[model samples]
Target chain A: MSALLTDDSIVDLHPLHIGTEEDGAVEVGRADTGMFVALPPEGVALLRLLADHLPMAEVRRRFGDSYGEPPDLDDFVAGLHECGFIRAVDGVPWPEGDDERGATEADPAASPAGGTTMRGIALLGGLGPERLRWLLSRPLLLVFAGVWLAVPALMLADPSLAPRPSDALLYHRVLPNALLVAVIAWTLVMLHEFAHALAARARGCTGRFSVGRRLVFLVGQTELSDVRTIARRQRYAPYLAGMTWDLIVVLGCLCCELAAVGGQLPRTVTYTVALTFIYQFSVFMRTDIYYVIVNALRLGDLMGDTRRLLANAVRGLRHSEPAYDLSGVPEREMRIIRWYCVYYLLGSSTVIAGSLLLSVPALVRMLRIAADGMASGPAAAGFWDGAGFVALVAFQFGTLGYVGFRDHRRTRAGTAATAV
Target chain B: MKIQIRKLERIETTVACACGS
Candidate 1:
């Protein structure tokens, strides 16, 4: 017998942002809730039919007409229902296992699928609401643009303003000085994220401020909910807001450094500012500049596409089956992806090499100094300094290790769930 | 009136049926 179906069992489609994947599959994302699912062409066709709110028999009939055979409508609908993509709009009860799934209205951040978790309380909901809206207005945006253009020109004219590796506030006496720098740097990062939130708010979009781990580092994130709906031009404000704040800080520090050339201000101040500026340009880490590039080119998933393209190239060389199929990528994006792959590889190599050459050596030296000081005895002043240094290093690396471990477990769980 | 108009425009542009039709 056919499954019990009711005329009142209308399916309400969740607001989804759809995009085409590289392999010609359809990717549908509920941006606000962060529910993402990929589907084959036939699955997408079924989704379209469901979105029409047709009765079960009508959907089945359409599916049969389109595919020239009977389709597993019940299984497909059940999967969608399970994923929280559709809901009953007519107050009708769902089939057996559906009600047992419980309510799906909980915060997506708390139970994010694919092993991602956005932890921490939101500090600010809407910041400087009216003032920010005014600042992001078209006329004021021109002023912002002028300032953005002038800062680079001003920096270029001043040879002292050029960012250099020596600009990093790394000194021999590294305990108190390093701690102070770390505090200030973190404050600046917070301000950068706040700028993004403000810009998003200005464009009538809500930005949620939270601290989350991105791979190894604890990052300040502004989750902009309405970005997909907003105009591309308005979207630019939030994407570039963090970098704009960084530039302002850099310029301000440069001015101060210029004024107090030798004595009043520590060179470390200017150096720290320059270091932040340089860090933003590390597009390999999906920094602000990376988003600017992606938005400017109007390409979806440039990083993912580039990675897949490179992986496929390597596979081709070894005559092994490629892990990613790139045939569905549009010609325009494919060309851009090819160039991006080259740049990304070269830039990543440079960053990796720089870390090995400079950061590793500095870390090793500090570790040795701290170890030696500890060995000298607790009575020595060096012992306290060494202990502080060791604590700081342990705190930083321990946090990194813990975050990486959590991410690994989440990824394994997600993969196992998908396999099942 | 302006806010309502803007909201309508946003809904028209952002919200869409799964079928392009």
Candidate 2:
């Protein structure tokens, strides 16, 4: 006896399943449903016979010749389609078309265009819809209001609330305290991830959770959700979600700082929150600002273009004309993207050079401070004092350096690829 | 008749958004 199955059963079966390994690896498995399903005694044999590389007519004839009556060929093929054992190629009509044997090769969603759609959707899911909608609607307005109220109020109340070495040295003065700030930032980032997950789930998609370094900053994120079928406009919200929340958090922090100042609360509470907000906004590296610019300009497609441009540039250096063609891109968009590449390329270089020029003094100062502390006493230069200071300095300069290097490499590659 | 022909031509030529080459 064979297991019973139906067309609906085959249709409902997931295209793929990922299994976990004992050693923390993932293995993807293909489910053989529909026509390939186990059936009563001779039926499995019959299906297997048809699965051979013989033509449809020949298979049907052979089945009929052996079994007296032929199985319904259309139904069998439809079952195969539902099971995903086979699929139509070129959107060609049913029956006589060739069935490409490999599972990966016959994928219904194989095109690069479809992959881009999926990636776009997944990025939006990561952004979260409600928060993203808020950003798109008017995040800058809220940010401005908070800045206007807080900056003036705080400055008036505390004349010394500036980004100076005195403030940096007076670390004990800033609070709700470091722990409280940590808790708040962590909560906000988690909320950002939740917004993404909820949006993805709403779209009938699923994803996995992960924690890793998003550029230089550590971030917790959900896996990219399948967005192939999602509409473009519907997607913009999810992409902007995290940044939206970040804006709100910044505003809330500013408001708290304002309250603390106006109501005569602890000075440390006001300063700490304000500083955190500023630190979040400081564009020394890619953050919310990166997403805003990337989406606004629709430069997701530029990764390939950058490579092509670099290749062309390299080719042009070798020969007169580019070996590869770049005529497919729209003239206006291409012009704008190229200009963006040039500006970003130039801007990053300036930042690195400027940073190096400025950082030497800071680095020397930090080293000198560490040296002085060590000379004075063990209490003055504690175990982690120098290491921590050095690490922080490295992190600050390293971030800018990394971005500069990546941008330059892309430009060089693009220029070389397309002789840009 | 002209409008019907135009519609037919569009039906034949109009590509699905997902079908980008």
Candidate 3:
């Protein structure tokens, strides 16, 4: 056991914001790690006292006065200490020892990209002006509402405007057009991510812009560090902001296509924009829509919980050791999990079907075309195109494999740590 | 008693509590 609490021991509690007092519970979030702990009222009171930098003896005395008994001060403190919620101020050894195995240290820059590449860019480090805040509020929100309503109405009126899988493949045939569309698409995605950052900034939260890969897809992420501290209404703004920009681009493309004299450029733009808009609806990946759903539903660890549930079910069928035991899950969340399981199946199937029908075919065609060009002659254009296409495919798949490998290794390390 | 501490590390939602909390 660690040393007992003394009257003079100084402690430094991690910076956190307490959630609204509701139902005899409070949500505490550490700002640095973005970790939330739902505590009973008594726990909140104890933590508040500790946060004031009071000695352990004072905290326990006050806690006893409030709760009618000298609560197990040592046990509670040990729990908090284990969770990295509190630290000794005078460099005293923690009761749990220096084994930082279980505590989650909040390091925002941690990426699967192996630390060599740039992870993210901090766009807004601090709160901005009143005007910027207002933009993220009523007027812009109303504008987004209009866009949301207008998009479906427009698509309904002009069914032809909806991009088809075949249109995406058109880029694969025309190399120059494909290159142009790729650059434009990349720029638009970055802008979409930037909009998220702007929304976060408007809410007086720091927004970080980052480019990373999730599986095979390249992603731009906006990290709103203080999002949990804000109201749910404010939280939805950043989540929806990226999709709002995507919709705008789609609308702009449609308008351009309607006004064009006669060329592939306008149609290409429309195709790319529409495809990008559709991509945002990919719920399997942590897309903008995924966040919107998560925030709206108030689900905590939905994916992880659902995954564990599935694993446990499979293990039970096979009569093997269960990977997860979920008896402790709240009934309400379990109900939600059931619904999420259905959606997960549907979403995953759609992605698989789409990839098989579209992406796989496109890749095979590109490979064949590259091979033919190389075998034909020393044709400079053909050689360059073939090399470029090969390099692009190699890089994409290589990064995906590398990231997957890293994640698997990290997961093993974490499991080992837990075992110890 | 061995309490399983669930770590909620995702950006969307998280909750920290002991096994029986």
Candidate 4:
């Protein structure tokens, strides 16, 4: 009970971070506790009254003056306590051990990637959110968009600037070409992730870069949760910024390719960027573009929700239940989910199939070439190079297998715990 | 007006780079 009948029945709340939501809601939370909740307008009013340190009786009277009916303050205050918003009740400190909230701060970038939990290391000049004031300007966004557009515009004018599959082989020695692509592509990848962190930071989000593996491929990710405080309009830049960087890079590489005297280095980079651009369309893989689509549509937990819907459908097949229950999903979002689920299904199958067909054969062909090189003695220049290539392939697939197995086991354990 | 109290949300946003085709 709130002990509201007394004259001095006052309650104190922890400092709250209150902000507006895109959908006419309110976001309230403690940044330290990492606990946030979305509330309607009247709830915000009630919170404001409590935050002003009003006594419960006065709070109810003031709230009733604005709204026709008084809020169920006991229930509301209880909810606040559950949310870790209560600091004290009637001069008594909030209990420490009893709350299930686990209110300790979470390391925003603490990732369990590669089977290790570690804080994401900041790289390549991460400026604080306040110092990056220009990121909020509209003109800077145009400059970014204009540069992205210029890449294709120039390629359209001169088709020679377009990337080709032939550009994959960059140097006389296979090892040097592989090394160069790895170096440049990874450097580009880091810059791409850094762009995301910068945009997020500029919008008052703190995040760090970490290396993680997704399915069969290795990836870099930025862990930022505070972007939720920003509206949907502001999120697009952070999500699409990486692709914009890739395009800007493609444009730069294309110009450099033209300037170079018959050298393939720039073209090689253009091809790598082009391949990455194509990869952004592989949305089922939860790429940056997936987040863009998610934010654009104002959908919550699209990936996890759709995955749950599918899992439920599989479990309910004998009962003839539908694949998804549309009761909880909003009508507008349901339309997108219908289309997106289909796209996800088709896209996932296509990617798995395409990778198996194309990448497997490509890997095999490369291995065959390396084997021919290895057939010769150490006197042959390609012998050690072939060995290096073989080792790289082994490491790539080796990491993939290990991560995949770990994910599978974790999923099974989660399922078992859910059953229990 | 009675305002509804929703559950706490963990607004985790991960910006990942995976252009793997």
Highest TM-score: give the candidate number: 3
Which candidate number maximizes DockQ?
Answer: 4
lDDT of 4 at A50: 87
Model 2 segments beyond 4 Å from truth?
A1-229, A261-300, A320-332, A375-384, A390-420, B1-21
Top model number, lDDT: 4
User: Cα lDDT of model 4 overall?
Assistant: 0.65
Candidate 2: CAPRI quality band: incorrect
Put down candidate 4 lDDT per residue, A319-394, tens digits, no spaces: 7656444354546766776677788788877766887998789778878888988899789978887887878777
**What does candidate 2's lDDT look like per residue over A99-144, in tens digits?**
1111123222121111111111122334444553343345654664
DockQ of each: 0.02, 0.02, 0.06, 0.33
Show the colliding residue pairs in model 1: none
For each candidate in the order shown, give its overall lDDT on alpha carbons: 0.56, 0.38, 0.59, 0.65
DockQ of predicted model 4: 0.33
lDDT of model number 1 = 0.56
Worst 10-residue lDDT window, candidate 3 chain A: A108-117
Candidate with more favorable, higher TM-score: 2 or 3: 3
Q: For model 2, how big is the CA root-mean-square deviation? A: 16.4
Please give, for residues A52-112, the per-residue lDDT of candidate 3 as tens digits: 8887778778888877776566676676665556656545554432212222222212232
